[model samples]
Target chain A: MKHTLSVLVENKPGVLARVAGLFRRRGFNIHSLAVAPTENPNLSRMTIVVDLEGKPLEQVEKQLHKLVNVLKIQDFLPHEAVERELALIKVHSTKETRAEIIQICDIFRAKIVDVSQDSLAIEVTGTEDKIDAIVSLLKPYRIIDLARTGKVAVSRGRK
Target chain B: MKLTGAEAVVKSLELLGVTDIFGIPGGATLPLTDALSRTEKIKYYLMRHEQCAAHAADAYARATGKVGVCTATSGPGATNLVTGIANAYMDSIPIVAITGQVATSVIGTDAFQEADITGITLPIVKHSYLITDANEIPYLFAEAFHIASTGRPGPVVIDLPRDVQNQVINFKFPEKVNLPGYKPTIRGHTRQIKLALEELMKSEKPVMFIGGGVVLSNAHQEVKKLAENFRIPVAWTLMGKGAFPDNHELNMGMIGMHGTRTTNTAIMNCDLLFAVGVRFDDRATGNLKRFAPHAKIVHIDIDPAEIGKNVKVDVPIVGDAAIVLRELNTMIENNNLKKTNHLAWVEQVFEWKKKWPLKTPDSTDLTPQFLISKISKAANDKDLIITTGVGQHQMWSAQFIELNGPRRFITSGGLGTMGFGLPAAIGAQVGKPNALVIDIDGDGSFQMVLQDLGTIARYNLPVKVVIINNRYLGMVRQWQELFFGKRYYAVDLEKGSPDFVKLSEAYGIKASVVSSVSELDEKIDEMINHRGPYVLDARVKEEENVFPMVPAGASLDEIIGGD
Candidate 1:
């Protein structure tokens, strides 16, 4: 089972390492993680999606709570939260293939951000499934470079 | 109020009621130690090595019920304390380790005498702090102490860089810590406590299981009362040895791995297991699959993470051991209910206890069991403390030594660190100056930190060291014989093993050698009667192995009776 854990940590040096080290030490597999500063400058929010491999999410949360730098943790069920992922892809483009690539980007609602003599860089942001679909569509092209920002999540309901 | 970070650190420790600390100073520690030297409130014990220093602080915490303090310089000194810090972490001993760090400017640059002690100890400690500002010294130190000694006790490391120590500020020590994420649950839920009580009341073959938490919380009295009221047999882990008095009828000796056959039988036969302050460590539970197959587990612990991690618990009560037990005891008393009689069940356990007893083979000459039993019997004082180095001697100490109170039996139960005995004895003696502390050690285990003999001698701790000199790492040799067809790889220590008696004498401590079985009692008495630190190296049979063994991954009932 996959678990998306929204963790609020003290904004300090080595907090990221502490969180990463804990997951590593406990043998919990991380699928994706995105970290950014919250509205409160004192706190940073980390969105970590982990593959528990039939292990209880409660165990992972309880262990995470033991870290002093970790201020709060909320495990969001898929339906309870809104999640997004961003990907930037650089694909080989030619005079003949550039028009076809632009059409595929339009169908996915992705924008062509940069154009070089031999490649076109497309920027896309959507649900993980949408990102996965676009990456698979672009795999046929000779991909030059790819970068992904792992999933960032927030609860669907109130503050 | 104006002071440097080093002075603030010393002032914070003084305010916290710390009278003694253990460590060795280096270049990075110069500023800190200089500030420490100005204070008469704390006396520092200079140890021979950083590892031994940490072990001493650990034992001091165990003996005194105070957060033990130790310090070391950067790099190798901090790295050396890792073994002892991990030992304390595993065993859940409350200790505060203050390490010197490189200047804040060169922290990540791999500067001279630089090491990230806080990061290195994150997984091992309950919490840690790397101080960046001198102004936060008092607050961080207070927080460190609070986190270390509260709900589930463990070690905490504070890494203070050299620049921070030298930075001057107006120090204002806080009375209470304000850590939003560091609150521990102290009271058990009323519903869960009631459920646990109802379950225990209905259980015909119930058993009370305990671990180091009970000892750490000093919940022995409550445990005894509850066990007697419910007519339940009490089985304990090695770390829980002193939680219940050995003389009680309900008391079952150490259970699991090296546990007595009697206790293991009772645990396996029980219908409901009331586990208090236990983590259900694999060594204590043996095979979790078959452990207490007929039992419904009621686990009450301070840390929620420990619940259902090892075994699925039926009624999980998260709270401090003493608080939970005290509430339960009151509930039983106030209800005016007639408790079910478990006389038949108790009798059944005793019958098993009698059927298979611990029998040590002494066909040839001196046996380790005989020597330990003699010392245990001779240690009649209420204040006498027993510490052990890991291996055959540790198991023998757990079995033969009779403990009637908490904090009297101290050993590296969780991490099983060797060379823990001698330094622990020193710490225990230092903490309890009027108490008699004895370290029962093996030759191989003793050789690891033998240099610390100078520390004990210099302090005149009046601690006694008894080496169960079998001339080999007996526990490993036994495992090789049983599990590996007697390969005996690296288990032999007969060649070039130090003469411990002469070595102790060389360090200005009293020393003796006892080669005959007849002189075992006399030598023990002499060591006890001696006014200063003493070492008694007693030669025993080389092939002696601890009995009533349950092989790894085997159930409790599958114990091999070597009798």
Candidate 2:
């Protein structure tokens, strides 16, 4: 099973390395990670998606808590949080296929951010599954290049 | 109130109640050393190497229960403290290591004596700081000390640039540290404690698996009470030696590989594992899947990561060992749960203990085990503090040296660093000036840091240094003989090892050699009675193996050389 943990750590130097080093040392498998400064300037929020493969997620969170810079960890269950990933896919587009690419982006509520003589850059922001659907739809057009901002999430609550 | 960063550091240390420090002076550390010298309250022990200094500081912290401090110059000096720092980190000792960096202007410009000490030590330290401004010194030192000494304690590094040390600032020490990310849980959850207590009450064959946390939390009394009042057998990890009375009736001795067969057997058959202050380290667990196979583990540790990281835990109480154990003991006492007795189980454990004890032949053929037994018996002080270097001698000491209280037996349990004993004894002696500190060392282990004997002689620490000279890397030799079919690769220490007696004498310390069992007692007395530091080289039979050996990764039940 996969676990998505929201870890808030002090915005000090080497904190990311400290957290990452712990994971590496403890043999925890991480699927994807995203980090950015939070609303509080002194703290950074890291969204870590790890597949523990039956290794208790509690153990990983507990280990992360041991890092001095790590302040708090809130694990988000799939239903309780809104998750998104931003991906820019450059697809091989011709004069005939440009309209089809634009149509696919419109249907998915994604925008075409860039266009080239031989390729079209499509920027998509949605849940991982939605992005994966869009990317697969454009697979026949041949993806020339792709950039993905793995995952970022927030809890869906008033608090 | 304005003072240089160096002066501020010294003042802060004085206020922190740091009475002694161990280190060598270098260019980056010159100002700090000068400031330290001006302080009459703190005595500094000049060490031969920065590694020795760190080891000394670590052992001092273990003995004194205060945060130990060590200093070194940047680059090589800072690097030298890595093994010692790792050792302390592994064992959860509280130590503050201060390293002098190049001036901030030349920090990354490849300046001489410059190293990224903070970056290098990041993975090993609890927290680290690189002084950017002189103003950060007082608060940073306070925070460093706080982080070092509090909750699951470990080493913290403070990298101070020389310019910061030279900068003048108004220095007023802060009374409190405000680290939003650094709060440690002191008390275990109430419901978890109740569940643990229930498990204790319901168990018919409970075994108390103790670890370094007991010594770290000073919870030996609580452990002893729980074991005695409840009639439960106890088995301790390497770090847990001296955390309980070694000769007690319920004592199953050390656990895991090379543990007594009795302890291994008890763990094999136990129904409930009341593990307190233990990390479930692989060395103690043997094969984790089969460890306490029939038991429901109730682990109590301040670090929650330690509880379920290695094995499946039934209940985990994350809090200080002393706090949690005291609560459990009080709760059990108040609830009248002491009436639950496992007499048959206790008798079964005792039967195993008697039948599967570590064997020592009664021959006079100069064995390490005999020497350790004779020394422990001959020592007069009830408060004897013994430290040992890594290898066969360490295991022999762990087996033969019977200590009555916590903080009495200090060894390199976690990292198993070989050169730890001498400097550790030095640290222990300095920390408890009146106590008899002895370093049970091996030839291979002693030769690693014998230069630090000069530190002992200079301070007249009166540490008894007993070198068990087996003329081989005995543990490795044993391994080669057993696992590798006696190929005898590089296990010989004969050609390169020093004449330990002459080596000690050259340091202006008393020295002697005892090669036979007849001279063991007299030589031990002479070494102990000496006013200053003394070294005894006990030439023992080579190629002896530690037992009862459970081969690495094997189940606890598959032990060899028992009885």
Candidate 3:
């Protein structure tokens, strides 16, 4: 099972390396990791999505807790949280297929961020499934470049 | 202040409060070395090998629980540090490894003496960085120290390219690091704590399996208090050696293979095994199925995966040991689950202890046991810290020395690494300068990084190194004796060992040689009272073995002792 872990750590030097080092040393396969400043000025939040199941996730969580700079670790399951991902895809476009591409974007609720007659830059935001669906739809339009912000999530309950 | 990489590294030292460092200078690190030559605030001890440098830094960190520092150049220099870095990661010691990389442009091109150090070190260090820009050096170095010294402390590396070392830049040490992806939870969930307590209260024959994490958390008092409150006999892993005083009534001593007979017995028969701050390493738990087979394990660790990695945990508290322990203590106090007596189990453990006493050989020559005891007696309980390399010496140190305080006995517990002593002794000495620091090392283990003698002498650090010169890799020989039917292949150490007195003199220190048991105390005292680095090269019987050793693949009952 894939695990998405939200870690809040002190915005201090070398912490990223430490966390990454720990995962690598323990042989935890990380699918994607994104770190950004949190609401707290002194803290940073990292969302690490790892391809680990059962006990390894527990061990990683426990180990992360040991870092002094690390303030919190929240392991989010698929159903317990609201997950979101953002992706930008630049597609080869022409007068002939431009309308068709725009129609596909409308169907997926994706926004066209940029258009240069020959190319269309589309931005999509949703759960992983939604993003994957949009990417699949854009494949026929000949996508030129693709970039994703990995996965970021928060719990569903009022906090 | 505008500074180059060398100056940033030097200034970063002051910022990190590092008064001394152990390293060697090469073409890649020359710029930093030149800057160090002019600095008076921090001292540098030139080492012979990068491995020795890393080990010394690691040792220093372990001894004092501070971030030990080491520096090396690019390529093989950085790779040589891999072993020591891995050792620190395994042992959970705080250390910072700084290496010089080739200039940024040539990094991927494989310029002379270049290596992908950060990439290579990625898995070993708690964190690592490749400072492509000189401006980032100060902040990165500061962050490295902060990360290395805090949390579940471990090694961190910063690879400074030579170009960065020469580039003068607008320098500003960031007040704080802005990494967003690394948060660690310090506190445990209240519900989980309550559940853990419930399990503890309901269970019979509960055993507390402690690891080095307790010491790292500085929760020895709390651990001892909790153990006493629950009347739980504590069985430590190698990493957990000094967490509880070995002489304490509840201490069954180090458990697992090579652990005490009583401890293994307790582990086997226990109903509830409460493991705190311990990773279930294979050495600690042989044949996972057979390990604590009957125990309903409550594993409290900061790492979540460890909870069910090897040994399954019924109640897993995924948080800091200190935080969880404090919570557990509070609940125990509030609920009043203190047992009046575990007299029967205590008596049973005592009976086992008496039945299988750690016996010594009848050889007239001095033994590692007597030597360890002599060293332990020579130093005060609170002031002196002991560090050891792996092998027979490490096991003997655990078995013989009564560690009354936490973080006082530093050893490569999880890694079982050789060449851990001298540098660790330096680290311990650096942690507490006023205290007497000693490395109770074996000759074979000591030779792994004997170059640390240079580091010790150069810094003028007061560390007494007592080498148990047995002229053989005693542990390997013992294994050969036990499992390989005494067909010793390559365990001999008769070739490389030089005269201790001569080696010490080369390092500008005095060394003494003792052959008999009668001269043990006098030699120990002489080393203890020496003003600076000293060596006691005590040549014991060549084949002296660490007894009461549980043969591999066998139960604790199959202990091998007696000649």
- Compare the candidates by DockQ and give the number of the best one: 1
**Residue B322 displacement in candidate 2 (angstroms):** 1.7
Query: Which TM-score value belongs to model 3?
Result: 0.80
**Interface RMSD per candidate:** 1.0, 1.3, 5.6
Q: Residue B254 lDDT in model 3?
A: 82
What are the RMSDs of all candidates, in order? 1.2, 2.0, 5.9
List the lowest-lDDT window of 10 residues for candidate 1 chain A: A54-63
Per model, the share of native interface contacts recovered reads: 0.70, 0.74, 0.37
Q: lDDT tens string, model 1, B1-563?
A: 79999999999999999999999999888999999999999999999999999999999999999999999999999999999999999999999999999999999999998888888887898888889999999999999899889978999999989999999999999978888877889999989999999998888899999999999988889999898877788999988988899877778788888888888888888999999988999888899999999999999999999999999999999999999999999999999655665678988988876776666565658889888888888887647899989999999999888888889888998899999998899889889999989999989889999999999888888989999999889999999989999898988888898878778889999999998777877888888989898999988888887878899899999888733
Model 3 residue B285 CA deviation (Å) reads: 1.8
- State candidate 1's DockQ: 0.78
CAPRI-style quality class for the chain A–B interface of candidate 1: medium
Estimated TM-score per prediction? 0.98, 0.96, 0.80
Chain A agreement with the truth for model 3, given as TM-score? 0.95
Supply the TM-score for candidate 1: 0.98
Per-residue error for A64 in candidate 3, Å, reads 10
| Candidates sorted on TM-score, descending | 1, 2, 3
lDDT (10s digit) by residue, model 2, range B357-471:
7767567699888889889888835569999999999999988898878898889998999999999999999899999899999899888998898898888888998999999
Error of 2 at A121 (Å): 3.8
Better of 1 and 3 by lDDT: 1
| DockQ of the candidate models in sequence | 0.78, 0.66, 0.20
- Assess each prediction's global lDDT (C-alpha) against the native: 0.90, 0.89, 0.82
